[model samples]
Target: LYGLLRRNFRIEEIQLVRPDINLLQKDDGTWNLPITSSDNGAGSSKEAMMLPFIADNVQIIDGNLTWAKVGETTSLSIQNFTIRLKIHSINSFPNMDLNLSVGEMDSTMISPIKDIKANLKTSEGLASLDNLSLNISGGSIEMKGDSTLPSKDKDAEYTATISVKNIDLETLISQFVPEAKELLKGVVDADITIKGQGFDAKADIKFSIPSLLVQDKIKIEQVKGNINYADFDFIISDITMNVFGGNVVGKGTGTLANISNPEFNLAFNVNNIDTGIALTALGQDALLAQGKLSGNINASGNISDIKADGKISSDKLNIKKMGDLTDITAPFRATITKQDKEVNIDNFSAKIYGGSVEGKANIIFGKDGQPHFSTTLNLSGLEAGNALKQLAGKAFLTGKTEGNIQLAGQGTDINTLTGSTDIIFKNGKLATHPIQNLLSVFIPALKTINFVAAKFLSTIGDGKVNITTATLENPQLLMYYGKGQMKLSNQKLAIPSHLLMRCDMVAKMPLVSGAFVREDENWCGIDFNILGTLSNPKSDLGDKLKGQAIGSAIEQIFGGDKDKEDKGGGGIGDLLEGIFK
Candidate 1:
């Protein structure tokens, strides 16, 4: 009798109790239901099953529904659901009114949403959502829309306006990127309008946040922006924020089609930023530098591989590390490129250290997570003595220095450095006490001559600076040519040197004249080594000179030729005997 009734008539009103429904979504996103029946024994006709029917209403009360994709463990479920549909007809182009309320909903894509409610009216292939609201992530969302239901001949289309209020950003972001919750904290509000056909959509959004904290290190205030999204791509405009005691304005475009490696192009302008605060925000010592900074920056590419260009200027900058550079105004520019865990700063120029500096640098991260760096720099008109004193705690030379340095190293330790330098010091004085005493032993006049010039070509490695070639000159009196090495860790020196005295100057120093050999018509020279620290030196000049003097007097006395022997030892023996006595 029930089978006969099902075949002959359509039920007008239907009701369901606390039913649990399970649905499986197919590959094409259509649900598969287990409501098939075997063909009626013999007399059942295809025309009977295809006949049109009518229903006044169908209702579900206190029900649960679970939906999952084929072969997937993650599922979406609605609990405590109540739904009522007033059906006008069940034929082609049917019409209905829908009222639905869901007490709770859970999905793998996000945290649970609750208290969903909606009211809709459908007629003649058009559906109007009078109201829809939900609560998610400590926030509320309200929406209203009109949609064209798809038929065999036409596709679906929709337009909607949604407003979201006071969403907890940390909670929302953690659903997508768990680690970000530790670095970001904020509240968000937005108003959005969306329009679409089928699966394609475009949205216009205006968003604002009152405050945000990053890594508990930087505080940003009053962030607002306008964004347009289409086909997984976004255009952002008129974004403004206050951070690090400065104001920033920016704009950009990006694509989130690949969420893990989104790509972007951005430009920003910053003004009146405090350098100390900025350094502290970046996890550096605030005492490294102090100033006000202004800059313009342009950047492109994904977060992991990006390139940037910028120009920055500072006012009243003071660099504490170099000691004497204070209240300096500086203009700087650079192009920075990053890829594969490496960063390169190219074509960088700066005004610093009472000089102009130009350079390029590279930093690469090793598998051990250590940073290795290389740099090449050209410096002009730098103060040599003051900078040296700041680094080594003593000034060995004083002058205006200019140089080119190429360096490569790992970590921040100076002992790991390997590099080369070509440097010159103009109008300088070698002021170390040991050097002055060593020179005075050979030429008393040198004790008073302070003006000097010097040049050095050196290589540095293994905590030592190897002076491959060096020259120091006091043009009127003497010059020294040397090769040496200094242990940077301890400032120990060992230099083998040759000293040359000018003939005109040597002629005036009678006491030292005969002990030195005249290497050429222009000068006389001696070989000696400058050993020990710069402050205290040891040398063999006195003993060498004494031996040479004795040799010279004996040669004069012996006269090494038959004619000279005959002509004599005229007063030579007496001089020698007096010397021996």
Candidate 2:
């Protein structure tokens, strides 16, 4: 039968190969059975002898069967007849929807397997790949497992590009400043992008850095032009933000040149900034000093070309803190130099009482930052008596006065003030409402004084002020050294007579120097020491007393006691005796 089998069948096709089956004892009392294929097969001899076995259901199948252990040429030996399956190459497996598992069939097959990486494709039209070439040094996922194709242009409505960073910023900063936990109490959250057309702008902002304990120190580096909403094309970089309590406002702009070195260009214009609220927010005593400062304030400037103009007006400015008028207006214009930090007043004027004064002053800051001022002022229709009464009380001024004055001064402080000006008093009308008027009736010669007084009043009272000149020194002495002359009643009294007889005469006040005196709309005199600011002093006591003829001699001798004697004869005697005593 063996000889016949070899001759009747193709010996190569009929050859049977079997693996070497081994059973080894392990240290744990377990057994390891390793089944491996034999290198040499029983070609003719084995086939010839197994012919009878082949006839009894041990026939060779149609196709070839090749099998081996993953790393070894081991034919698995199991319960009955050993069967072999052959696969040409791993590429034969399609990379499609296929579910497969690989594992050892028995407990003895404990040899470890190397990683089996594969691409999957299936007959049902799905494909996937794991490309190992494009991986970063660190662990990263590099795979494409898309089940769908790219959308066509006609079917796409939006396109999005996203970039995500897995690094933690706060964790990184913590290494430098361990106390950052107490410093920065918040995280950074910002969304910035550059979209398609009309979305070219970009904005970056940071807020509430708890590590620094800064509520909101925001900085927007840049934003595209398309996002400028309010009809303004703002090109800014390094723009810092301001945060007060909870309110946030954008303040400074950065320099476009260097991204790190930023510049600030902020201009805030608040038409009505609630100063009361601002003061309260500053933790100040919240009492309304001035009702409400409701006006426009515009501050616009750059570090290089900074120019600011602000005008503040209130409905009624309070002098509560100052202890003065309850209501008044103070409007001023200020111009400051950015380079030098010097401030100059182009115009600063206010209307107080019934008068208006306009002035222009400049403040020159010294090396120590002290301010010196050179100011010029023009006052119109100022009521001198009213102003004096308001300033020093009603007891200081004896009569009402209407005049205009001009002043110029330059000083660093109030104590060292120096200035000069001319004051003109017009339409002088003496209201004969005082005690001195009763003495005018003594002598007939006094009638001349009366007529002269009346004439001076008539010319000045209902008319323009009769002041010919009233000059003041550098440091004005209101009543002392100021001096001037008057053409009284179209008559030239001796300069002395004119000055002594006239009710309103320009003269230096009695005690003070450099100040002028205008007495009762009739007489004026200058200080005898410093010649008058305008001219020499003048007086006319001789003509004044001579004109009151009849009792002039006796009046002169007894004029001092005459008033006392007239009060009451015995009273006058008692007054004289008391004086003698």
Candidate 3:
């Protein structure tokens, strides 16, 4: 053999019989060969001893190899491998065919793969995988591919198609994402095509699923979609699913170029969604509301920032609270937008209690993750008695009301409230028992007075509500005016007020009318203070009359000066001036 040619050689056949080999892989994915001192010396003269050979055929039979990496429990074993090579000449590339059958392949990162079989062929620098099949996690995967080796002038190019069928989602995904095991259950299928040159690659993926259950709360049915990826970006289309008794369709685009802060733009349309089911899916009590909901949403953003716009509407929403159900008869509609930690709602409209409401609102999240909100609402022709009974479980007044309210607050506490309200009532009467009881002390006829018109104006801040003006008019009887502040935290009232009546009306009830002082030939007035909580009020009219005569008390209360009486400084002139001012 030493005397034979080393530059050119020919062999008809060579065989490897029942060989077993073990190889170590380095961290960088390169093999680490076992070399002794003598083997090293021989390898140093490898170029001089190298031979170019021509073989008609060569084969390896019953070969077994185990490959393992340093400091890792994961390893791959190939068994019962057979290979055949056919060579025509030393200058021509050989043809090779190989088949591998593995009884079992196991790794810590995935479940064992069983009954693996593969067939591969090669000519020159090109290799083709005719078929590769494996069973894993109660499912199977089939794959085929063609690849070319890289040369000095070009990068490797490859194409592959993979088919996955009925893979156990929880069993498979739990190996990589353990936390999701309890949150997910289902089976999945996919057909994927991948093509690439070196690191520049693209994939087209189509996936389908019969059903998926998430967190034991939501069930998604008939999910199907297709996605295309190229240049680190993904385009998704034709995605549809059913959940919450509704159908949803969606499309989107996303980028993975900067994976830490990847961006996405997505849109979704939902139709005929059951509101109770949707609320329950979001961890809320289903009894809160019931109706059908429809919506469209568009969103764009990166991980830490987002912007969204949408519209939502419903026609038959009924709210349930405290064993009561309130029907909203008109269609409900709202437009919503969000940026970062702030959300804005616009063009919100609804009808209830035979009245219409229109409003806009804004919400902001602070650094501490607490929410602050503000809103303005206009009400038209609302039945006050019905509104009060529905909202408060008691009817405090009966009338038709129109008003506008502007309010801002933090969290859910009413004590943080700051706002203003102006309201007008038509053809109404006070139904509060405490207020009626207090008024009866002034005049027996005041116990059940009906007002033709009433108005209230107030502003809220600093833990108190400032009553800028409050008036009631009964054209046939009397007029009333009041001003005061109410403590918001406790609903306590402190108001100074006056009741003015025509002398003719007073003369009709002379017994209780003694408390009224004649302010003029035509008018009689009684000044009093309203005290106590909003639910239980008290008056000081009896004490004032007992302490002094009605005329002297009235004069003293108004800074009496008979000498300035003619200058519009006292009596009816002064009382009207003070009330209006």
- Candidate whose TM-score is highest: 1
lDDT tens digits by residue: candidate 3, 192-227 = 999999878899999988999876657889988998
How would you order the candidates by lDDT, starting with the best?
1, 3, 2
TM-score, candidate 2, is 0.36
Question: lDDT of candidate 2 vs native?
Answer: 0.32
- Cα TM-score per model: 0.72, 0.36, 0.62
Point out the higher-scoring one by lDDT: 1 or 2: 1
Could you tell which candidate, 2 or 3, scores higher by lDDT? 3
Cα RMSD to native, each candidate?
9.5, 24.1, 11.2
Q: Which candidate is the best by lDDT?
A: 1
Model 1, position 459: C-alpha lDDT score? 98
lDDT of each residue in 11-54, candidate 2, tens digit only: 22222444333444445433343222223365422211222211
Per-residue lDDT of model 1, residues 534-580, tens digit only: 44456666555545545655566554566644765444444434432
Overall local distance difference test of candidate 1: 0.74
User: RMSD, model 3, all Cα superposed?
Assistant: 11.2
